[model samples]
Target: MRAFHNTVLRFAACIAMMLLASFVPAAALAQEKTSALMTPELLEKVRRANNECFACHSEEGVKKPPRADLDITKLRPLAHDPKVFNGSNHGLMECTQCHGQGYTEFPHAADARESISACEECHAAKVLRIEKQLDASVHATRVKDKFTCSTCHDPHVDLIASTLIDPRKIVAQDNQHCLDCHDSELEFAKFAPDDEQTSTKKKRPDIDKIHEWLPNTRVHWQAVRCVECHTPATKTLSHEIVNKEKAERQCLTCHSASSSLTTRLYRHLAKEEQERLGFANSVILASSYVLGATRHPWLDRLIVGAFAAMLLGLLIHGLARIVARIVRRKKNHG
Candidate 1:
């Protein structure tokens, strides 16, 4: 019996050694951390492919600039952190996924195949079949930014058990997920404290505390999904529309209005104000942002031309009226 037990113990030890050999070494894991940590080598290799994209883009550049503006030799680390995207998953994703061809190498960015450089590469089949049902939802549109797939979805820790797919579900889940990060804005910090060791977390901040800060939409937006009000069209990752339309719709929908367009011209952007909006609106008040818009010479010319045309027409009509009145008087006198 002792001889048999000794042989069994030796077999078990050999099996354990083989199992230990199969495990990933700490060094390999550290290398992955280097890549994910945004090390100089990785950043340089990625930046080398397309560096000359900042010629015409006002203040914005490739954080991913377009191919025409790209210059391969001038990539540099940004001095300031992008606020709207401060903690966003875009920080960890690969550049090549969005930037495309020779992006991995120092080649001309113009050679990028615009069509294929989209979410469709991985999700095209799953998305195409579904959007076919929804009449091509906004989710199907190709993205232009230089973020990778892992930006939103953490590739390192994908638990297949709770995979989300539906757009509405995805948005709702994402909104809740964002709240986990943005609780300070919501004043929910009292309840969801970050400490994991003590077991004592603060209570949920009163709805009143929340109400006092946002003041207006705190109650209503609490019930609605955050994404619904903050319709983000770009992958730039900042959603800051005040949902003036939503507030407008709520007023029109409930408070008795003749039409949904009851919102005055001042409430929304004018035709020329389109370019003035985007990620900047996320930080500042909407009204204040509109007030600070830069006026172009063409805009002044347009306004002057409109006034000139209106005055000219008015003068022509007045002259015609005076002539008709004199002719009528002459006829009566005759």
Candidate 2:
């Protein structure tokens, strides 16, 4: 019996050793595969390749997009397409946005595949941090649909549109975008807008209208831009060595009148100014207060309709008061 027990124990040990041996080769194969696909040197090559691709594609275009309204058929650098270089917008993104990955080596394009990192990537934290402070602190918390860094701020080229193109304007789109995502606006009746961004954009669509109309507006109001006031929260701004360098504010600092934000805001100017100021939160409030105003989307119709009714009521009251005065004046003259 003792001899039989020793034999059995030896057999069990052999089986365990065989199993361990089997796993070793498999693990080695896996490691070899990973090493084959990726390496520090290879990654550097990819990065360098990507930068070259972007340079010509973005700064110099071979074939300009028709929608961009810029003709570049004769443009050189056929190897580089500027659209491909303008940073990734998500390939599924759009013609203008250039699908977010920018360009990759045609053969190795798989590396640019969208991942969870795309959503939880560096930009994500940036947006969330700003919003968190916005909710708790003075920054504008309300954000619009599809609220993203790309939404209010563009990452691609160094720009602040210098022309008055409708799409470039920030007024109708900007502050309203801020109001859309703000938690306080939805939960509370109104938010006390403060942060440099929110405070700067406290007025709707464009502040230029106020400044333009003011008699001494140009001189009294220093022109401002979004970047001037809302720089990276951590990286503080300093214009001059004077007075310890006051925080930069106003559009003129970096943005000429032609900045993209200014231009986009200008387009919405043609639209009704007062209504656009009705951000998602204010729209919600309008729904609560007004009646027979909305007949469209559940929230939109209700909110917009309420505000419209109030505006209509005020117009009617003003007209009625004017008519009454006219009638009284006629009676006195007769």
Candidate 3:
């Protein structure tokens, strides 16, 4: 019996060791990949170079330009928060790397502006994927040549949404990109001009009035991203922005057990939740309370058990009362 128990213990120990061995490599590989992307030494070098550029291109720097005659609007495009840039995915890159060595001068050369590298230059693979999706989008089809990557994404401050853990933060950032164009009349006119001279120009719709049909519009806006409805429901993090006419209008798209949010707004969290909690829609419960959707299997079981117990207690109480009443009647008769 002792020998048999010892053998079982050894087998369990081997299984535990194998599991630990498997996990260690995976964790190490992830760490290795992150370090390969940007080491501390490289990050420091990038920051130093970026700080020098920011000395002249930052908000305060842009206000007091080398040339007083320089239009603030022209300088505004160059202005960006240094702290925000450092926190972004592109934080490891130097300014001159994209803008060219011409910017090394006190006042950048006029020709240097033309040398600024396109987003496609560095992000070739990503751009290729986005281009395919963009080709099918309303922006590309309607605006044609006028619309580009920078139209929605401000490269200076843009962060990779998938890497972010917080769903609310991701929604806030992504929605802001949409609102920047849709909400502002000046920005809206850029793509959809309402000029009477150009009869072909698209008229801007009243954004708030259009969304009046949605219940608790403010809550919906805060909790979910615009892309949840605007983009294709079939794809995850799809760039294909659909027209208002084709946009999702059904409330059940989100307010259900199998919510479309699992594939859209909360996609980053959904996969993690599935791995951690064995529930994909668990992401929704963590972030926001979606009616008819936030149900957990264990929680539902507990609720049912409680209700059953309550009914059983009521039945017992009723039986005891009837028994006592019969005894009292018997005593009275005696």
What is the TM-score of each predicted model, taking all chains together? 0.25, 0.26, 0.73
Q: Which candidate is the best by TM-score?
A: 3
Candidates, ranked, TM-score: 3, 2, 1
Give model 3's TM-score versus the native structure.
0.73
The segments of candidate 3 whose C-alpha lies over 4 angstroms from its true place after superposition are: 1-41, 64-73, 193-200, 274-280, 298-334
lDDT, candidate 2, 58-110, per-residue tens: 54444434235434453342344333322222211112112233223332244
Query: Each prediction's Cα lDDT score?
Result: 0.38, 0.36, 0.72
- Local lDDT at 297 for model 1: 40
- Model 1 bad stretches (over 4 Å): 1-92, 105-107, 113-116, 136-218, 226-334
User: What would you estimate as the lDDT of candidate 1?
Assistant: 0.38
lDDT of 2: 0.36
For model 3 the local lDDT of residue 231 reads: 83
Write the number of the candidate with greater TM-score, choosing between 1 and 3.
3
